[model samples]
Target chain A: MDLVVAVLFQLIYVIANLALISLGLAIIFGMMRVINLAHGEFLMLGGYTVVVATNAGVNIWIAMLILAPLVVGIVGVIVERLLIRWLYGRMVDTLLATWGLSLLMVGLVTSIFGASTATTVAPPLGAIRIGSYAASGYELFLILITIVLLIAVWLTLRYTKLGLLARGTMQNAEMASALGVSTSRIYMVTFGLGAAVSGLAGGLLAPMTGVLPTIGATYIAKAFITVISGGSAILAGTTAGSVLLGGLNGIFSFIAGSTFGEIALLLAAIVLLRLMPRGITGRFFRKSL
Target chain B: MNSGILRQMRPTFVYALLGIIFMFAAPQVLQLFTIINLTTAIALAVLALSLALIWGYGGILCFGQVAFFGLGAYAYTISAINFGGSTWAILMAVMITSAFAAALGYFIFFGRVSDVYLGVITLTVTLIFFSLIRRTSGPEYKIGNALLGGFNGVSSPPINLPWNPTSFLFPEQVFYVAMAALILCYVFAGWLVNTKFGRVCQAIRENELRAELLGYDTRLYKLGIFTIGAGIAAIGGVLFCNGVGRITPDVFNLYNAALTIIWVIVGGRGTLIGPIGATFALFYLTSALGGQSVLNNNLVLGIILIFFVLLVPKGVAPTIIDWVNARRKKAPGRVRRRRGSRGEGAQ
Candidate 1:
């Protein structure tokens, strides 16, 4: 019973973590058809921002609250204006270009910060215990904040004028332009928003994983896998993908080992993709995007 | 445009011949260490050439050629160390690695995934392979021979060449061997590009639907070409292990994979020789500019890549070639006639 509880707790953590990152990917892919290979690097950038600021004597929470999203948003704008904008339509170019961008980001980080792994401290408060079982307050805070953000995003997308404009631009860019919606601005803003979300996710997760130069290198692939498996179109799929990947990852890591767990996850995801080309949640959001 | 005039001064081909001559003579002129580094660059170039062939001509854009390269590296090390020393061991290793690549490529290409998605699949496979290799440190699993050293990689005793003239002349002998192999690969690839198989592959790249409509099996060609490329990459890996005198999991990491991709991109892709030239030039540049000694080498590399992607997308070699062609075609009458035709077409 204790073992089951431990597994369930870990599964929840994994799902929440995966969903936070995958949500950013889903928005980018759905809004721009350009699979941002550098998405993980953006997450790493956000994590690093908080780390750098805190090390410079800023309060960790305050640093994250102020600098994380802003840094990522600025990077998004620069990347879009300089690189991503040129690769708007050509999918392969976008893939290669973003790959180049990813390499540049990693190289720059390594050069600037050195390759040594950096760590961040969690909030000083201890775990919140209920009976014999205890959970980190930090983890709970992350879950709550993510939940709040998810709801806020859902409500905004479903009931806002900007959301309508975004939806219009996503569904048919030329048609939206013909109907007088400014899609170029929408594209820029959506890219920035996606980067901001990635930053926010990074800030929340940094306490657990800390700040390594290649921090998001591992998560980038996982995020892409989650996004594809969950169906790029559905918010629910991102959640589903996160839970599926995170839970399977945690359980398998516990059982088989980290390497084998990763292998098994990959093998399962590939097999699943072969069986369901549209993805598991792709069915529900087939035409939504 | 008589054949003789074109043949009399093909600067590109002449430059290539000059490069081959210089590489062959490098061992005699340079120190032992420099010669070894050149050989290493040659081996890396061979692998990069394979990437360009697949990505440039076939339009497959595989970001995971290093996985195949790693497979080859492991295969050669394991077979030679365990099965006893023989040249045949190396040959078998290359063949097996090629077969593995073929199987993976078959499933991937025939699955009807689009080219863009194929890059994702290949990249995923590479990362998964990296993770799997790292995980084999546990006692439960062993990678082939007992020497498969997990993250530390596998190294072996000096290879006992069947026709060894002298054991101490290893570096010189290896340089000669690498040059001969490179020439053979270049000639074979160049000839293949003009063959029916190559023509069909190019057509598939140019227009997949038209090729399919014409009843050509596109997947077969992609698989065949990918297999060939993988086999070549394996050959390069074997050469690499032989030159380095050791192999580590680090040899097959993301950075190495990124380097291979950058080599092809920085060199012209469609032409086989482009990446071959690029591998040498870039490696030499890195060595000369103190790539390893620099504090921020990765950042410098990143900046270089970004610059190339933004301003030199056709790669350095192809851009230079284009400039040469333009200069040679600077006849006023010919230029006027071309402009006249363009103006007519616009109207």
Candidate 2:
């Protein structure tokens, strides 16, 4: 019973992690139709923000919760204004340009901080006991935070004015423009919001994974897989995709090992894509956001 | 009609003549190390050409072309160890890689996967290959006589003289072979783009729905071009391993994949000559940067990519072509002929 409980906790954590990493991409790619290949870099920047801040004697909680996202959100705004705004609707060009941006970020980070940085910050809150098994308290916190984050995103999209305008613009930019909405500014804000969300996820994960410029490469693939498998409904699809893929990954990792687990996740995604190329939400939640 | 045919063939004929001359004359002027570097660059140009063929012409922007490249290198290395020869190994590499691509491409194109999903799936496959190969560093992962050296990579057997397996080609000889292959592949690609099949593929790229309405099997054409491109990249991988005398999991890394796309984009897509020139130019530029250690190569490359994508999206070749065409438009007696040729070229 203890083993089952522990495994379940781990599985939920995995799903939450996937959802957190993918939510920003879900908004940017799913909502805006712009494939930001530099997404992983955005996350990396967030992680670095936390690390740099904490190292400079700032509180860890503040760094991760506030500073990271704020800094990365500003960077995201700059990126949008400088690069992304010019290449809207050109999907392939966006992919190429953002890939270049990713490389540039990696290079700049490497040159500034070297290949790796010494992260003194560790996963906070320590360990928690669950019957015969013990789990990281930080992991539990992460799970809770992910749930809160998802709900917050859902609420904002459902109720907020910015969210409403963003959704309207995404659905029909020309129509929204005729109604006197500044679609360009909406795009900029939405992109920055997505970046900010990504930054927050990166900051949150930093303590567990540590910060490396190259770490983005690892996160980018899984995040993309999650978002692509999630289909078009940003929030609901991301949740569904994450649950399915993350559950498979966690269960397989528990049964076999991490390598096979990863392979299994990728294989499952491939099969899922073959069956439903439009993604899980594309087939199931056709009406839901 | 004869004059039209002659005019059409003139550029290719001149290109072939220049390539042959350069192949023989380059070694005389360059040092051995420079020649070897050129050989590697030529191999990469072949890789770029493969991408140009698919993404540029076929309209399939595959992010994982390096999967086939790495597969080819590994296949060649493994097969060479088994056969104790290079000729059969090269053939095996190309065949195995292309077959794998065909299978994967079938699953992708035939499955009606969207463009974004296609990119993700291909990139995932590449990462899987990278991670899978990296894990095979154990002594138990031996294939035939070759040990999958894991992350350490294996020292590839150099290409031997086809008639004499005991005699390996010197770096100079490899340079000659690489140059010759580049020329042959370039000419072959040029000829292909002018063929009926190529036109259909381009038509499908322009409008898949329209092509389907016209009774063309867009999926089949995509798969065909993708497989052919994979085969060409495999050949490039074989040449690359021959140049460096090694094969590693690094070939399948995301950095290399991005670099390949950068080469194609900076060189210009939709044209054969653009990617080739861009590959050579950027290869040398990075090498120079490495030597100088002034500015970071990735940063420079990133900026170049942004600049080209934003301002010079037509790429160097097409831009040059456009400039020349503008110049010719001012000249008398040739304007009408140029317009006629331009219309045909556009199609």
Candidate 3:
């Protein structure tokens, strides 16, 4: 009974973790249809922001919660303005360019920090005991935070003017422009917001995964699989996809090993994609945002 | 890929001539080490050529091309160890990789997966391979006494003479084999583009819906080119393993996959020789950077990608061709002829 509860808690945390890493990518891809291959780099940058800021003696919470997102958000805006703005609508070109950008980020970070970064930050919360086993209290906090983040995003998209404008622009740019919405500004803002979310997630995960110059490569394929498998709907799709994949991954990791877990996640994604080419939400939740 | 200038002479003839010349001349002038490196570069060029045909011409943006390349390498390595001969191992590698590609492509193309989704699926498949291979370090991962060395990887067998199995080929002989394969591949690709099948593939690339309406099986055509591309990439893998004298799981990495795309993009996608040229240029450029600590290779590559995408979007060969065409038009007779051509409906 104790094992079951602990397993369930870990599974939920795993799902939350997947959602946390993938939300930003889901939003960006869902809105722009421009698959940002540099999404992983953005996450990495956010992780660095926290690491760099904390090393300079800032509070770890503030660094993770605020500075990471802010720094990466600004970087996202700049990247959009400088590189992505010109490549809008050309999906393949955007992917390739961002891939290059990803490599550049890895190289730049490696040069600056060297390969092995001295990670001085640790998970800030104490462990919560589950029967004889103890689970990291930070994981519970992360799960709560992810829930809040999802709710916040949903509220913002459903009720906020900017969200409406952005969604409108995404759906039909010409129509939005005709209705006097500055579509380009929305694109920039949306991209920045997505980057900010990714940054926050990265900062959050850094304590658990640690930071490396080339760590983004590991996260990227997983994030891409989640986002693409989620299909078109942003919040609903990502949530659904992450839960399914992350749950399976957690269960398999517990049962077999991480390798098997990874293999399962990837295999499930491929089969899911083959079954529903447009993704789960693309087929099921055709009306959801 | 008909870079008008390259095609000015019979492309096959020109490729054959150049290939033959380089095959003989390179070993004489270049260092032994450089010749081996050139062989590796030639392997990559063939890989790029495969992409140029499928992505540039067939309009399939395969994000997992190296999947087949790695598969071929693995197949060749394992088979050579088990079969004890390079002759059958090479053939098996090509056949296995092509069959695997065909099977994978069948699911993707026939299932009507959209373009972007196709990229996701292929990439996923490739990552699966990478993940799967990285864990085979245990003795349990063996196929007929050939251990699938996990992270450290296995050393591929040397190519022995067909008649005398005791006499293995030197690096120079491997270089020769690589060059001959590349030239043959180039000539074959040049000839392919002019075929009826290739023409249909191009038409399908231009407008899939239109081609479908015209009663052509676009899926079959895509699968055909994809499978063929995989075969070419497999051969590249064989050459690559031969040149390096080893096979590792790293060949299935995202970096190599992206590098293949970069070569095609920078060298002019629609031109065969362009990517081959780009492969050699970038290959040497990276190697040169590797010898130094002053500059970062990835950063340089990133800047180049951005610069090309922003400015020279048509890539090197086509950009050069356009410039020459512009200059040629400045000649009095050419200018009059061009002007007369444009004079058709001025009013």
Question: Which model scores highest in lDDT?
Answer: 2
**DockQ scores for all predicted structures:** 0.48, 0.63, 0.61
Tens digits of per-residue lDDT, candidate 3, B1-347, equal 45542443275576679789989998889999899899899889889888888887788989898898889989999999898889889999999999999988877888778777787678768877887898999999899969999987789998888746578899999999989989888877766765678778888888999999999999999999999999999999999998998998999877787788789889886678888889999999999999987677777887788778778887897777668878887767666444322211100
Candidate 2 local Cα displacement, residue A228, angstroms? 0.7
Provide interface RMSD per model, one decimal: 2.1, 1.4, 1.6
What is the fnat score of candidate 3? Answer: 0.53
- Best-to-worst TM-score order: 2, 3, 1
Measured by TM-score, how close is model 3 to the native structure? 0.94
How much is the lDDT of residue B90 in candidate 3?
Answer: 90
Top-scoring candidate (TM-score): 2
Candidate 3 chain B, poorest ten consecutive residues by summed lDDT: B338-347
Model 2 local distance difference test score: 0.87
Residue-level error in angstroms, candidate 1, position B142:
3.0
- Write model 2 residue lDDT over A229-278, tens digit each, in one string: 88989988899999999999998999987778888888888878888988
What TM-score would chain A of each candidate receive against the reference chain A?
Answer: 0.92, 0.98, 0.98
| Model 3 regions more than 4 Å off | B1-9, B334-347
- Candidate 1 deviant stretches above 4 angstroms: A123-125, A128-137, A281-284, B1-20, B138-141, B162-169, B291-295, B332-347
